[model samples]
Target: MVEQQQSDDNQKNSEPGVKNSIKKLKNKFVPGFQYTLIIATGFNISMLVIGCLNVHKCPVNKNIPLFLIATGAIGIISKFTTYVRTRFSKHIQVVYFETSLYSVESIFFFLGSYWVYKYYKPSYDPTDGDVYCNKTAYLLAFIYLTFLYSLLLVMIFGCCCAFCCLLCLGSGEDTSKAGCKYSLLVAAICNFAMLVIGCLNVHKCPVNEKIPLYLIATGAIGLVSKFVSYFRRRISAHVQVVFFETSLYSVEAAFFFLGTFWVYKEYKPSFDPDEKDYCNETAYMFAFVHLTIYYCFIVFVAFVCCCIVCVAICVSATADTGVKYTLIIAAALNISVLVVGCLNVHKCPVNKNIPLFLIAVGGIGLMSKFISYIRERLSELVTVAHLESSLYSAEVVFCFLGSYWVFKEYQPSYDPFDETKYCNKTAYLFAFSYLIIHYTIALAVLLACCCFTLCCMICTYKVRTCCQDMVSVEQENDTGIQYTLITAAIFNFAMLVVGSLNVHKCPVNKNIPLFLIAIGAIGLVSKFVSYIRDRLSKHVRVSYIESALYSVETIFFFLGTYWVYKEFKPSYNPLDRTKYCNKTAYLFAFIYLTVHYTILIAMIFGCCCFVCCAMWMAKAENSRSYDVESQPTNTEAREALTTNDESEAKP
Candidate 1:
């Protein structure tokens, strides 16, 4: 009896342990899904690039590549959310973001499918003169969709088999419970049937319209019945509710079957663009794509329901190593950016600003990531400031500026006739849209910052009290100085990138941008090294080196600023490109010079104030010493009077 009791206690203790292990395993599945999704995004970006390269070929339908870019952008955001959730233990906001992305992506995928598959047999060769799409682009999209559908079917079949086995092993009560859930099965079946009817009658003019209306009514009634059953718990299990659900499903299924038969019997394709016939190719193609996706979604839902146990065991082994995966994703994205930019340059060499912008951003991003990796690996031996965020912030500013320019001066036209006059629409749109997304995000962040600042000002006392509790005064000062240096370094790096891109464009004073680039590079190195030295004083001693670098930077900045001002042109004439300097490059050079001068002036003003304060303190100290020396002491006066009295007595 004692041994039996001990065994029971052990089992009780192990139950919670088992439950916890299972919970952890379930939690890991989402990250695995995230990893898979990110990998898929890389493929999507590749397809977008291919489509962009062939944009001149598919002039009418830019939607394919546009959709790919849209999905890729959303995927990046989703990956970011996954990283944040994993890093911070934040769940609720991540869920909301994920759900929103999923819904938007679903709509985008359906529309893309409609557009891509509509031209079922488009000519592969450009010379064919038919509705042609690039063979590579078209095949990639087609294969992806085909594989997706096949996987859905397989998952659905596997789930059905699993469910049957479960039913066989289940007790009588379990079977009874399963029977009670027949309403759900009937609802799913009816939904599938409606989908088929919709697809069949999609191109049938009058009948197509009526079929959707019927489906909507059936869906509404089913939703209402389910809600009624849910709210009335006492009657949820009643015979009336079950009978009503069954009758509703049966009516919808029967109506859909009849519509399908009618459409199948009378179907005839109309090829004339202007004619209205029984079967419209356009409408049928659209409906067919949407309904097919809907069918896949149904199968997916059923698979999820039946394979919950399998999903629990589907946790990725690398889920815990999110940082490495994130780095990989970043690297892949940067490489794609570079490739796309290079392709754009190769296609249209007239406007190199936007392509070079892509190249610069991608290059800097990759460099920053490499530096971060090195810092992390050599964390014990060498200390490097976390400047990745600062670099990215600078990239955002440049992207916003570049996008503004693209929108104003270089917007591409979708007209096929204008292809020769403008850049490839696909490449131009990809760069423009990519930059615009970053621009919008940056704007939102700026607005949020402004709002938060306003709120802090209004609640200054509360903010101050909270900040005092969280951080020390010294820590606050250190953080401020550190960030200031980082900001300076980032600006210098930006100057280098912009200046190098524009250096070749200057006609007479080509050295202007080059000078700025050299000074900016020196200043950047100085600031970075100074920050490192300050942070790790024991390991690094570069005070004199930093001072010399800054001195040279100051001299070079003055010379560069003068050259830029002297050579600046206020107007740009695109037709006379040979005589005049590129206005865009000159403008950036001027901007960088002006900003650098402003910073230099501020620093000089601060140094003068420090000198004046120090001089005043010294003069005050000297005067106090002189006054003390000039004054007579009480003991000295008493001794002088005593001496006088003794002399008078002697006389």
Candidate 2:
């Protein structure tokens, strides 16, 4: 009786993944995850039924059943597969069949994306009666379907690939392997087929549409799959080589952006000119067309390649084959980019600084993991954390001294404690102060972080060799300890990734952190220079003209201020400088002045003092009094005085 009961339970457990999947798959024959499939089918049916009755009255020739029930049939099949898998345990046999089905569907989707282009050719003249086609609709549906599979296939193929590679995704942790495997298989097959179909669609012609709807459909599947698969992570791997290779497409996008302004920039240079003489520019335009197509193909191929590589890593790592270099490489790329940003931000000439925030953002993920790793090591006070934190404190002094010396020598405004007058960027001073404090603490912690990582890596290496149990979440839970460890870990982690990417992308192949500091250093230097300029200027308070006279230095001061603000906003409040009134209030006043000036220019008594001065100078240079020595200044003439000094000279 116990044996029979055990058998029943085993059967029951397998049903959800396998049997339900079959049911879902069957239901798909009628309906699926997306309602659009049915809606599309219905619309096609309506068009078919309606068009037949009034085929003669139709504005232009159109396809009837070309998009009707048959189109919907494919979706129904897909849904049925999903439902069936949910009902039972997926055996390898069930998974194999599911994979096959999705693979078949992927092919049909590719064909559909381009089917209309061949049929509905266009004519320039309306009199030609050349039937027009909404190739867009077909492409849209194809893309929708293809990606839908991509989402499903990621898991399915991941499993297949994992099984082939690692022998299994999980040796024992995985349950419901029955129907689940089949669902996974279906998903994989869908992804594989979509990749294939997407590639085919890249060649579909989309001229009149002036858009690559078909190509978009192919690419959208992978992107959508990625998004859905991610949630869509309960959801879904070598994101590096994949994303990097895919960046080739980004180059395409870059070219596209450039072409809008630089018509000649491209993978294959093309021309765009007067339509009257198409030949001259046609070659150029044709090249752009080919390049665009190439990019589309690259996008599709990369999506699949990325998925495959990521999965391969997971499988290899899980199987203990030591295939972790790609992960490291990805980590490296992220860091490199961030470093590049840091360096370029500082190195690039003011007003043309590369955006660093965007580059650093990509490393956030690596940062998180790094922090987790650090938390593991630093949780114990007796560890390297204490020594490193202290060391950071010492580095703070040197960092500040270096910055101070550079500023005082280069920037005449290098007063850390002195009150600043109007026009001084108070916020910048505050940022420097805050940076002094934070950098001290951060350096200490990061120093600890670096030590901890190296030590941990050494230990991890040993542990891996010994085949010992790895640390789990339960290993470190102390909040205070966790905080110190995590922060240090995060900082270090970011550093590691930055370092691993060979620090090439950051500052675009330069040391970003150093670059930021250098930039701040330069800005600090300029501040002092600006202060000296202020002291030397005739007007103690220089406004518009003085600001212009001291343009280069003045601009550099503001650029430095901006860098401090952008790079260190969290370290200090710009308004607290006590330097030039409140930073916020000062900026507000400047803004108000600008607005007022704008309004004045729009009105009449409207001539701004600046504009008036310009006009006055222009007129004065060519006046009738040109040869008259000091020709009784204009005021004397206006006063009707004998163009002389006061009648009663001073005694």
Candidate 3:
């Protein structure tokens, strides 16, 4: 009996020890999971810095550095939001923000994966010519992707085991919790799998190129819609939001169905480096499975919708008028576009740009509709000024680059004998017209704004009575000007990317891109500093710093503008290319400089007008006060005027 008692005591002691160990493990795991993202973000920033510094030497794909910067920026922004929410606004939920950001990052990762892995084996030396990437950048990206997939597999296995255990041995509540977790895991896994397949590019098939773009656009729209819904509480209940989202998903589903058809039709077992139809068997099968899954999900959703409609009809329930009309309109438009694209898929054998044009048009229409919905239904709960500006900046850069590429590869007619010269005339014309219209409208608006500002200044000087009102107008206009400046800063970054790509090739002017990059970096940093200062304290003066940066930018703008103009040539002939500058880089640099010059002129005129008005008002107030004092004004009135003057001068 004594021996049994001793054994029981030992068992109880071991239980507490095991509990302590488990507690320690949980503590370590929790913090590790929390901080892993931050650590990865730091690594990403480091890679971006390194990539930028060695951009000229490395000649790495511009997309890689862009991806790094985008991911890093999102991570930093997320962390900032988390800090703000925790410290100042507990009412603000960050889950939606985080999820949207993660979705965007995942889309970027998919694109990056395609860019990096498509070259499976890239030359590290720049001298190896067009097919080279910086070794460090390439390996880091590869390893990060590999690690993510490995972690995903581990999570899948763990979730499966936990789910099985809960189903077999736990109570209903526990099983339900486990099931929720399992469903989330499954969704993540499926998303990752689809991304992997969509990014695979092993052949010259349009499906391979266009699938990624479709997936990216779908993800982007979804992220934006989620953001809108998150901020606008009423939007969550709105039928329009539901119809818009459903329409988007339906379009994606139909596109995926089309992709699956193409993939199956063009499947090949052998990989030939020289052949156009050289899809890897493994890659094709993976794409097939994922696309099939997507189509099946769409079918299932449609069936459910049909059943719901039937039940509603039986019960005499009525759908919202707006919802029904929106659904019909969206379905008609999306289906029409998809059917047209599918029918014309084979019309352009050499020019993939035709399909890109279709995709671009659809994307633009959807985005425009989404914007209209936001304008109509947006709540007053949150301001999306920065978000809108950021989107606009991205769109501007994308359109500009698309225009450049389209211009470069334009062919007037199809050539059966020469594959390089073959292009569908209709597609080329449509794309050209689309881009030209955009540029024409943009430039005209910019010129109109400049002319309006100039005219306003002239009128203000002539009519001194309106000086006070003009100053107030200018103050109100500050927000719009700030957005324009922000867009310019983003354009500067684009210029840097262009410069980096063309720097090595420009034998005559190697330092021009570098100079532009330096000035751009300085300008970007100045803007960031000004922003932080405004946020941290109202008393801090950033005008002097801003002035100095602007001065430098202006000086460089003139010098760079001169160099770009001097080096510009329209021809891309091999011999002429050696003598002239890269037309794309030079053209973008010129535009960047011109934008800065315009902003500088606007700022100068604005500041001058403000100062002149202030001086004129001060003189008038002095003259009026002197006259009042001469007339023997009461002491109380004089004291009141003195107090007002002091108050105005205090700042």
What residue runs in model 3 are displaced by over 4 Å at the alpha carbon?
1-38, 59-70, 91-100, 114-139, 169-283, 289-293, 296-318, 353-651
User: If scored against the real structure, what TM-score would every candidate get?
Assistant: 0.36, 0.22, 0.45
lDDT string for model 3 (437-493, tens) is: 665664464455446545754775557555555576655565575676668658766
What is the clash tally of candidate 1?
A: 0
**Candidate 2 regions with alpha-carbon error over 4 angstroms:** 1-64, 67-70, 88-129, 132-215, 232-269, 275-651
Error of 3 at 213 (Å): 15
Which of candidates 1 and 2 is the stronger one according to TM-score? 1
Compose the digit string of candidate 2's lDDT tens values, residues 1-651.
999999999998997879789787777854343355445445444443443343233123333223322334333443334434443335212332333234334433434444543444343244545453334433444455456556655764564454565435445536554455555455445434434543443333222222233223333343333333322123223122222222222222322322322222122322233332222223234434544565476456445545654565455434322324434554454455445544443332221112222232323323322332333333453232322222222223234433433233223243434424111232223224434554465557445544654575577666655754745443443234435544533443443333333322222112233333333332333333234333334543323222222222222222333222222222124343322222332232234334533553353222234335754785787574675765676876767664344555643
lDDT of 1 by residue, 1-651 (tens): 999999999999999999999889877875586568558656756765765566556643555555555555444444545544454454223443343344344435545565676566677777766566777767776776667656755754564565467557755555544565565556545545544454554435543444343343334334433333332332445323432333333333333333333333335645454655544554444434444454466457434533532342264343324654565576567667767876775454335466666665675555555545444444565433323333443343345345534654455554545645466666677777776665465446445534653564477656655774565866678679778987886777777777767765666665665675665666666676667666656866655344435434543654565467655564466455554566766777778767755764574456446546755886899999999989879999899999999999996
Model 3 vs. true fold: TM: 0.45
* lDDT comparison, 2 vs 3, better candidate: 3
Compared with the true structure, the alpha-carbon lDDT of candidate 2 equals 0.38
Ranking by lDDT: 1, 3, 2
Q: State which candidate has the highest lDDT.
A: 1
